[model samples]
Structures are given as C-alpha cells and as structure tokens.
Target: MIVKNEERSLERCLQSVQGKVGEIIIVDTGSTDQTKEIARRYTDRIYDFEWIGDFSAARNYALEFASSDYILHLDADETLEDPNNELMGNLDKDFYYIRIKNDLGTGLVLTHQFVRLFRNSPEIRYKGALHEQVQLDHNIHQYGYLSTLILHDGYKDDIIKSKQKAQRNEHILLEEIKNNPTAFNYYNLGMQYIVAGQYNDALNALKKSYTLANNYTFSQKVVLEIMKCLHELGRYQEAVKVSMDAVELYENIPDFWYQLGLSYLEWGMLKDAEDSFNKCLEIGEEKSQELLNHYDGTGSYLAQGQLAKVNLMLGNNEQALEYILSAAKAAPNVTGFFNIFLSILPNASPKELLQHVIHIWPYQTERHANLIATLYQQRHPLLNEFITYHNLDVEYPISTLHYIFENNYERALAELNQQSQKGTDHFITNNVILLSFLLNNPNLISEFKNDISLSEKEAKWFKNIILKKVPTQSIHVNKALLMIWKQLILDLIQLQKYEFIDLLISATKQAEFRLIISECLQQYGFDELALEVLIECDNSHVNRQVYMTAAKSLIKLGAAEDALFYLSKAEGVHLDFNVLFEKWRIASTIDKFEEIKILQKMIQSYPESRWAKRTSGAILG
Candidate 1:
C-alpha cells in the first residue's frame, strides 16, 4: 500500500490485515506524520519512496518488495472486512475482483469491483498517475469476483475536506492527460472534475472521452457521467437525449432507466419521469443482479419510492398510494419509504384508504390491521361521514379504534349494535362518540358523552364545538386540546366531510368561523358548500371581502342572479376596476340594475385610465 500522511487511518488498516495476510508491505510517499511508526506495530517491511507525483510508481515500487505469491493492495483509508481470509486462502484464477464499498457519508455505500488481488510478477503492474488500474501483458488478465468487501473511508466529507484531494487529483489527472491523452485518462479527469463539483468541466472531458472511446468499452460509464454533469448544469434536454441513446443500447439495464427518470423528473417532465420509473420496476426483477451493479436500490426500492412522489405530483393519488406501499413492502427495513407513503397519502376518508390497504397487506397477516391501528393510535384526521356507520367497545388505543381500524362500516356497526346499549369502558366511550361522528350517526354522541374519559375542559370543548349549537367564546381549552380541535377543523375541510361540516355549522353561528370554513372549502373546489357557509355569515353585517367571495362562489355554481343579490348587499367596496367590471358584467346579464350607474361609477373613478376608456367606448359607441 502507498500512502502519505495517513496517521489517522493507518493503524486501523494495518490492524485489520495483521493476522490475515502473510506479510504487510507499506511504501511511504513522504508522509510527514508517524504513519510509518504505526505500521511498525504490525510489520517492519516499511520502505520509503520519494514523492514523484505518480501513484502507480509508488505502488509498483511496493510490488517489488512483496515476497508472497499474491499482492493484495489497499490504501490507509481502506480495510478488508470480515470473512476476508477465506477468499485470500484460495487461488484458482490469476487475480480476483474485490468489491470496494465507498463510504459516501450519505448513508449510502457505493460498490464497484476492482482487480486488487493479483499474482506478484514482473508483468503485473498498476498504470496511470491517479485512479491507477492494474495492467497485464497484452491486456490478457484472468479476473475473478469474490463476495468479500473492502470498506473505504476516504470519501467521507470531512476526510475529503481536510485532504483537499480534489485539487491534487485535478492537478495530477490534467498533467497525466497532457502526457497520455487517452480516453481512459480523459474519463479519469472528468471524474476528478466531478469531485470538485465543476460539472461543466466534467461534461466537456466526459464528452471528449465518449467521442474517442470504443463503442462498448467506456461508453456506458462515460455516458452516465456525461448525463450526470449535464443534469447538474441544468442542461436536461441534452441529458435526456444522451440517456435515450444509452437506453436503446442497453435496454434491460435498470441504471439507465433510473438515471433517465431523474433527468425527466429534474426537468419537470413529470409524465416521462413516471414512465421511466415504471420501466425500472418492470426490468428490475429480470435484471435483479445487474440492477445493483450501479445505483443501489434502483432494482428494488429507489425507483418505486421515487415513482410515488411523481404520481402524487401528477395528481394520481390512488396510483401514488399503490407505488409507495409497494416501495415499503420492497424495503420493509427502510423506514424512509414508509414515511414517503405517509406523506403521499391523500387527505381522504378512511373508506378511501381502506381499498389500498386491503389489497396490499391483506388482513390475514394483521399487517393491514396494525397499519390502520397505527394511524388512529396517533389520532390522525378522521373526517369521514358514512351517514351509514359500528361498536367494538374493545379496550388506550380502541374498542372503537378497532372498529375504525377495521375500516368496515357494516362489520363495525354490527359489532357496535351487539354491544350493551351503553359502553362500560371510559376511553371506549370517547372513541364511540368520535366513531358516531365519523360514521355520520351524531345522535350516538349523546349516548356516550357522559361516560367519556376526556378531562372536564376537553368535555366542554367536545360538547360546545361538536354538540351544542352555541358560540365557543365561553369555553377555555388548554393548548393541547386546542391543537387537536384545530386539526379536526382542518381535517373536516380537507376531507370535504360535508355532513360533519354541516353539523359544525349548526353547532355555532359565529361569522368568523363561518367565513374561515367557507374560504377553506372554496380552496378545495367545494364552492357550493363554501357559498352555503358564506350565506350564513351574517351577510347584513359582513364586509366587501365576504360579499365578493360569496359572489365568486355563486358565479362558479352558475347562480348569477344570487351573485347579484350578494353584490347588492356588498358594503365598503372600493372603486376597483376588477370589482366594478365583475359587478357590471353580472348586472348586464340581468336587466335588474341600471347599467348606466356602474358605467358612470367606472368613468368617474378612473376618467383618464383604460377602465374609463373601455367602459365609455362600450356605453356610447
């Protein structure tokens, strides 16, 4: 191994191979620290070499001192992991391809095979100044693959930052390219540019490599790097074109599809993104081994998880749900996919979510049941109104929670009817009340409100907000209960639970709440419901904003005459062009208002403006 100033990581690397290897060969390339002293703890076969600005030269020097038949190469930041000796103990081929895992410091391990173990002979020697590759006579080398991995710590962000390796690598690769000027050397320079985050430089070198390299030799890897550089540079169209050519050449590889999907996604070409990810899933199974050859999880979870986000953005909620659940199943140990599933879930009724759950994780395994229970255990939004609704008066989490978890109105309601007329458990009573509202049988709330386990303040909140048709001004709730109540209001709006929303409207006649509810409903296209709430907002005392909002919602419902009615009650309306024009437009539809009055108002407000000119031309032309 050739190293310089690797005191921090040298001892660990030496210890990992102390007992496993026959001899340790260390070649110091002018290290200013105690790296050689640390090596002395294990072996005294340490040799000093001058800094020649070429790694291959130092590595070749170390190769000359090895007395063993095979030379296993490693850097100070790299170590052979467990069960490594077994591979080293046997030798059927001239050399073996050892998998090196690069620690990206991103919770991701990148694996690539290299000819690190080989017979120590005069013919076998590493070439190139940086990112050197082992070369044999006439390029004829028998390489074998072993499952043993070498953990590399050099790529960690902190280590790279301290080492300033990108600058040094850039300098070496540029100097090497000046001398050799080969396709492989260009690819090396491109990789160094990428490490330096100089994407434009990477693209230029990689493109040159692509043009000069053989069709199949370096094209696959260079194409990938070129596409990545283009993506980073915001040249997505070029990236997609390059990726497509690669896909046609390597059709079954999941890596190309995965990369192409990212190209489309980052460009906001969502449909193409969706299609590419689906293709990854399709070819992932048949090409499972190749899928992991690059871009880990492309074959299993990455594409599936990413597809969930794409579908959600495209407004395909059901498809998004299926994709995310599939991602969770594919990577059950990865909590990130499940978190994506939660985030992608539509603000929908429990009945709507039940369909996706039943088919994905069937109730036989109790996984679907447990998943449903988990949501309710956290008391997530439950704004569903069956108008049809159950009673399992089971036990903190639920007797009614069980019924809700079942997500079955018929089964839950049947079970509830079988229970005694009144529930005995306190928390069960509270759930029964909530279930009653959820199931659209609000009358059941009266039967269980007395036995609810909620604190007295919570009871008053529940009664005043959900039960009594009075203003909530008199009740004082603590912060926690208030938060739950606010979430309930948001859920009711988001879920469009019209029946329960109507119940809340009747429970309080406060104009502020009515206006708030109306606005939220309109945001989700529930304009008719929004208009109804606005109508009950004490229109006689309401301002211009309420009147204008009500008129807009009325217009959406094709209620032009009623829109005029609300506009007629409008007060404190400023002489704005949009407001006046809308009122005039609606008024012109009916012969009810004097059009001349609005025409005069428009003319008088902005006599020298376009509004005045436009209205004047139409009025007197």
Candidate 2:
C-alpha cells in the first residue's frame, strides 16, 4: 500500500486484512502523521520513500516489498469488506478485479471493479500520475472479477473539500497532460475538475479526452463525464444531443440512458424522459458493471425516482406515488428520492399520499415522521389517519387539529379530553380545549370561555370559529394565531362546512388570512365568492402574495378593474415576476396600451425572470 498522512484510516485498513494475508507491506510517502507508527504495529516491512507527484511510482515502489505469491493493493481509506482464504485459493487467474464502492457523502455512491489483486511478477506495474491504473500484459495475463468488495470513503464530498485532494491531483494531471497528452491524462484532469465543481474546465478537458479516446470503455467514460458537465452548466439541449449520440453508440449502458432521461426531463420532454428511464430499468444489469466501473450504485434506484417525477408531471398521481415509494424502499437514506416524493405530495390526493407515507414509515421512521409533520403543518387532509397510524408523539393541539380536519369531531373531542388529563395548559392546548368544547357542547362556551386567556387575535379567531362572526375592524395578527386559524379553516373546508367560513373570514383582520380564505374558496369552485372575499379585504395591505392572489381571483370573476387595482397596489411592495405577469394580464384585459409599455420596461429590468422569459417568447414557445 502507498500512503501519506493516513493515520486516521491506516489501522482500520490493516485490521481488515490482518489474518487473511500471508504478509503485509506499507510504503509511506512522507506522512507527517502517525501513519508509519501505526503500520509498525501490523508489519515490520514498512519502507520510507521521498515525496513524488506520480501515484504509479509510489505504488510500483510498494510492489517491490511484497514477498507473497499474490499481492492485494488497497488505499488507507479503503477496507476489504470480506476476505476468504478458500476464495483466494480457488482463484487461478493471474489477476482479479475487486468491487470498489465509492461513497460520495451526498448519498450518491459509485461502484467500480478495479484490478487490485494480482499475481506478483516483475512485469506487472502501475501507470498514471493520478487515479493510477494497473498495467499488465493482458495477452498473457488472465484477469476476471471477484465477489470480494472494498468499501472506500476517501472521495466523499467533505473529505475532498477539506483536503482539497482534487486540486492536488489536478496539478499532477496538468503536468501529465503536458508531458504525455494521453486520453487517460485528459480524462483524469476532467474528472478532478468535476470533483472540484469546475464544470467549464471539466467540459474542455473531457472534450479533448473524447477526441483522443480510442478504447470503447475509455470513450464511454468520456461521454458520461461530458454529459454531466453539460448538465451542471444548464446546457440541457447540448446535454441531450450528447446523451443521444452516446445512447446510439452505447445502447446497453444504463448510465447513458439515465443521463438521457435527466436531460430530457430538464428540457420538458416528459414522454422522452419516461421512455429513457424505462429503458434503463429494462436493460437491467447486463454489462452494467463494465459500463459503470467508476460509478457506485445501480441506475435502477435513481431511475425509479426519475420515473416518479415524470409520472407526477404527467398527472398520473397513483403511478408517481408507487414509483416514489418503491424508490424510498430501495434507498431509504437517499434524500433525492424523498425530495421527489415530497414535491408530489402537495398535488396528490391527501388520503392516497397519507396511505403511502404510512406504508414507508416503518422503513425509516424518523424521515417519514418529519415528512408527515411537514404535511400536517401544511394542513394536508387525512393527516388524522397518519397520526393515528403511527401513534405519533406529537403535541396534543396538532393531533386534535388533524382529527378535526378528518371530520371526526367525536375523536377530536376524545383526544382533547385525553390530553386535558395531562394537565398541560399552553395557549395552543387551551385553544384546542375551547374548540373541543364548542364542537361537543356549543352552549357550554360560557362555561370554559373565561377559563382560558388568549391574545386579542386568538380571541377573535376563536370567536369566529365558535360564533361565526366577522371582525369589525382590521388588526395586527400574531403568527401562532394565524397558523392555528389557517389549519382550522382548512379543516372546515375539507368537511364542506362553508357555514363556518364566514366566521373564519371575520376572525382575522390580516390580509394573509383573507387571501387564504379566497384561495380555498376558489379551489372549491366558488370563484364569485372568492372574488367577493378578495374585494372585501383592504387593498392597502402591501403583501405581494395577497395582492397577486386577489388580482387572479378578480380577473377570474371578470372584474378586471378590481384586478388592476390590486395589481397596482403591489407595484413597489413586491415587484416580482408573478406580480409583473399579473400586471400584464390586467393590461391585456383592459386594453391599456400604455400598460404594455410599462411591462416592456419591467421585462427589460428583469430579463432573466420567468415573467420576462414568458413575455420574450424564450420559454414555452
């Protein structure tokens, strides 16, 4: 083994192969840490070497110390997962490629088969300054893959960033490219830049490598790196073109198909994305290891996540849910799969999404619980079932809110009664108790009304929920009261209890609540009622979201004048792309030619904005 400053990992590496190997040898290249000291505990055959930029040189020097008939090479940060003497004895080949799992620390794992175990010979050596390759006479040497696996975490993001190891490798690779200008040198340089997040540099180097690459495997690696660079640069069209060319040449490689699917998704080609991702799944593992030698993990897991996204975009919620759940099952710790699942939850049917979340809850309870809590906080329907299914140890008030949302008022009251016995009397719990009293015994509000003290806003909200009355004047609202009020409003909406909505409207003077009420009404197909709610709210309120929502609702109700009024109110307070688009719609509706001139000026001011993109015919054209 060739090592430097690997004290942190040297012992573990030595221990993994302590009893399995006939002899151990360690060649240190100027380590300042206790690496050599630790190596002394395991082997007396430790040698010191001068610092050299070339990895192949150090590795070759290490090879001279091996006295065993067979040599197995490993880095300090890697460990032989399992070593079997019987398996080693059965191997008659001159060399064997062992599986290496590279953990990138961002939940992205790449798997590669590397020639690490080989028969000791004078002709066998190593090549390359960085990412050195095993060199041998393949015509005379027989090499095949083995079931033995090596776990490596040296290339993880944090380690790479902290150590700047990629930068160090880049220097060596640059020198190698200057001296040799080989396809392998350019490829190594490009990959080093990729690890360092220098995509443009990576792209230039990878393009050069592609020009010189002659071996099919080397060319495939070049194409994948080029596609990755283009994808990161947001050149989706170019990425798609390159990926298509790669797929035509390497149709059986799953990575190429997965890359094509990603590019097609970014380019808004849903059908093409679906077909490409499906091809990845259909191709399976045949020749996959050869094509994905430097990458870890199968494309199947990521392909499922992509398919989930594609199905969601195509409005196939059930299929999307199934695919995402399957992905979560395959890789529970993969944040990308969970992210896609969460993105679809807001649009999926509440009960269906809840059922799927429950199904996966047992696999990764903490992750699923956090997700369930987020959905509950968003007032997603059927949250009562989620809470009940998991028996979540959440606060009483939130659980009571879910029960109310599920229209199980009796169960809601039961939860309140159970929590009341605990003697916890916070504002939220007190408010929930009062809500339960009102739901179970409407005439008994006077009995419990004086027992709980609430802020003026909370009092107003409670009065509205209980008495169904609107406030006489607008007042500043507290955030906590607003959250509780919003959840209550969502519950009433789900139960189709519109009669209580009037009270909800009256309970808060904040334009935010009025906007929420307007949106809920609109969602329930009461466009005129939504407009009426928006019209009643003071337009002087400078919240951009409220103004934009009001403008849209007014325009939907054929009240262009009212829409323009709200849009104008949002002029300086929130001049974002959405607000700009709303202004354009108002201008088009009222035939105000001057307003179009203002829009042109606005688009020029924010040329990269989505509103500008739409108006300039750059997107969706």
RMSD of 1: 15.5
For every model shown, the clashing-pair count is 4, 7
What CA RMSD would you report for each candidate?
15.5, 10.6
Model 1: pairs clashing at backbone N, Cα or C within 3 Å: 390-412, 390-413, 391-416, 394-399
Error of 1 at 489 (Å): 18
Candidate 2's C-alpha runs over 4 A off are 83-87, 292-299, 347-621
TM-score, each model? Answer: 0.56, 0.63
Cα lDDT tens digits for candidate 2, 279-315: 8889865557866464443457778888999998655
Off by over 4 Å in 1: 82-84, 137-139, 215-217, 285-293, 317-342, 345-621
Instruction: Name the candidate that leads on TM-score.
Output: 2
Whole-model Cα lDDT of every candidate shown, in order: 0.68, 0.71
451-518 per-residue lDDT for model 1 (tens digits): 54456554554555554446545454345544444445555554346677777667655555566667
Consecutive 10-residue window with the lowest summed lDDT within model 2 = 607-616
